[model samples]
Target: MGLFGPSEQEIETAVNAALDKRASIENPSVPLSSQNVLSFLGLDATSSAGERVTIESALGVPAIWAAVNFLSGTLASLPLHLYKRGKSGRERDTSALGVILHDAANDETSSFAWRKYIFDQVFTGGRGVTFIERSAGKKVINLWPLNPDCLTIKRIDGRKVYQYKDGKRTVTYEASEVIDIPFMLKRDMLSHYSPILSNREAIGLAQAVTKYGAKFFEGGGVPPFAIEGPFQSPGGMQRAADDMDTAVRKASKEKRLALSLPAGHKIHQLGVDPEKSQLVELQRFIIEQVARIYSLPPIFLQDLTRGTYSNTEQQDLHLVKHTLRRWLTQFEQELNLKLFGRASARQYVEANVDGLLRGDFKTRMEGYARAIQTAQMTPDEARDMENRPAKGGEADMLHIQGATVPLGSQPIRGIGDNGGPPLNDEGNNSNAA
Candidate 1:
């Protein structure tokens, strides 16, 4: 009654009465579509637009319990993970990890942020907040809370307002029905945001791995910065190294290979136990797969698996696509944005030779081998080909001169001029010598 103008008990009575009335109207003994059943309760079609409301309502008690448990358990676990990831600094006053944990006791937004750290990547618009508004021709789902539970659908027409010929306009606004279900909410919210987050994460991870490979192993730079004295403390460094070696060997032997450069260099690599590496890789893989699901620009995956056990490539890609798609359906119908379009975009690009040049060197080599075989050229014949000469002579032979634009004037082009073409379309004739 405070905000809704009825006591909780009164609302419950009304809701129950509406449900009974609806059941009788439809068919008391038959199973009905949840929407049809909900409609009998006076929660009509307009309220159910862009939503799967009835299912949540049917599972109301379970949904609430699930939310409560999530809020209590998973939400509580993030700080520990963050701390382990070094969100808190090393060398704190105590060895106890929980001492530095950040707690958001009373803040819902902060709690939401923690939820985002977990599920937002897998959902639409990072936990969708939307509302339905009717214009003349279509429904406008206005952006609202990033996470919305109570949405009011309003209907109005241009006729309700003055046509520049009437005085005061009559507007019809109502809270038609409630869409307070968890799964539908989760679905709608996850769809728009998950693909974006997943795809972005995947692409970013790929880029990072690509860069890591290029910078450290391929380019001969220092390996990642490690904790300084952990290796020197009595038997500590040796144990860590041995553990890393053991982990690598097991991964190699079990065919559980993770990302690595040639000659046993790791990309986004950590030399820890297989379990720890898996955890780290899982974190990285999840991030990358989500990014790829969202359609980020082309990210090159270097064959860091280079001559080892089973390829982690397929496993990694499979997880990414599966997770991304699971969350993609949630926001797609509501937002109408296709998050899985990037693979198609990539396929379109691969139809040309440009794809080969931009592809991994192994692909290029295979292509070259295929070309050589198809041409039936002997190694000696292929080796005898000469480099083609350029049609235009070298610039050094032409005595070409270059210049810069004056401070206040636009640049000009053509013989003797340093600047680009003059402003006039008359072909640089406007410039005074």
Candidate 2:
């Protein structure tokens, strides 16, 4: 031991001992692993609704599929651009890194595909991870996605590291080398809460309702019924019941409107119909639940039960403001941090959500006109946003409405004929006064 402090060997031993102690405390017997093999296999504990709500099962629900697919596709379709901060202002970075973000992450995968895949994992598996492959000079070469199921995250020496199991070999990556986005993080910070797992009851109920409806319809929309007959022996009663079932099925198959039954046998409907069970209403409610889980408005999930012209428009705004903005910001920050590092003050990534308004021609035109008249953006800039070629010259200069002058800076008199004098409201020269 040194006089000033503990020896380096002692510190190493202490750190190792602390890690071991933490492991033992966290998992006394077997080590608690984050491997998602069971989840990948669509195996999870049965939900309250008596349905297995694994990621796959939850996705089998139409509402969940719509929610996840809509969000992932919408985010992926947005244009991501890399920008560099300069003395003048921020300008779009047109370097290879920018291309990697805007166009393609690698030679084989497009930016859209990569982003969609990442968010798909986030929504379903609860975490999305991508590795930034860098060249020897620290230049980004390719962005590769890592399967969240096979990846485990740990904090080692006060730094987060990722361990990805690739077949028989395990590869380790530093936090800086990975872009990690979680649907929701747990208290441990290493693990995440899956949407399907957290809200399994709602999703499971949806699945159950769908399955029940399907089975009901598959039986030719026939409700379960009890056949009451005058039978003396139990064997005769069983045979009668089987004959009734077979007759009902044959009648359904032949599209017969009426069925001939045994004498003195009455068919009593035993279960409530789908309408009485409120299956449609229940399915709609489940859709709303899913929308809530993803922070989406019901309109986005194609639920028009309460949609109106004005409210639907408001929901569109809400989707962008409340839903897409959060995800876009999270993804952008993650990309900027992993690709450029925290110390990189000049360059960062951004997703241009203005593309969402592309279909709103009138809105886009009016917004561009307002921006131009307010001197907020030049004509060329607006054109560039629309992917149109710049007209250059005066079009590149910021323009404002000629009548938009300072409050107290109005001219004393308006120019008259030949620019000689001013005209008044009475069509006379104001100089006469």
**What C-alpha lDDT values do all the predictions have?**
0.33, 0.83
**What tens-digit string does per-residue lDDT give for candidate 1 at 1-64?**
3232332233344565656765895656544344454445543423211323222231232222
Tens-digit lDDT track of model 2 for 247-327: 878888989878888689898998899999998889889988998899999988889999999999888988899889999
Misplaced by over 4 Å in model 1 are 1-127, 132-135, 139-145, 149-309, 334-433
Candidate RMSDs in order: 25.8, 9.0
**Model 2 regions more than 4 Å off:** 1-44, 403-433
Candidate 2: residue 39 Cα off by (Å) = 14
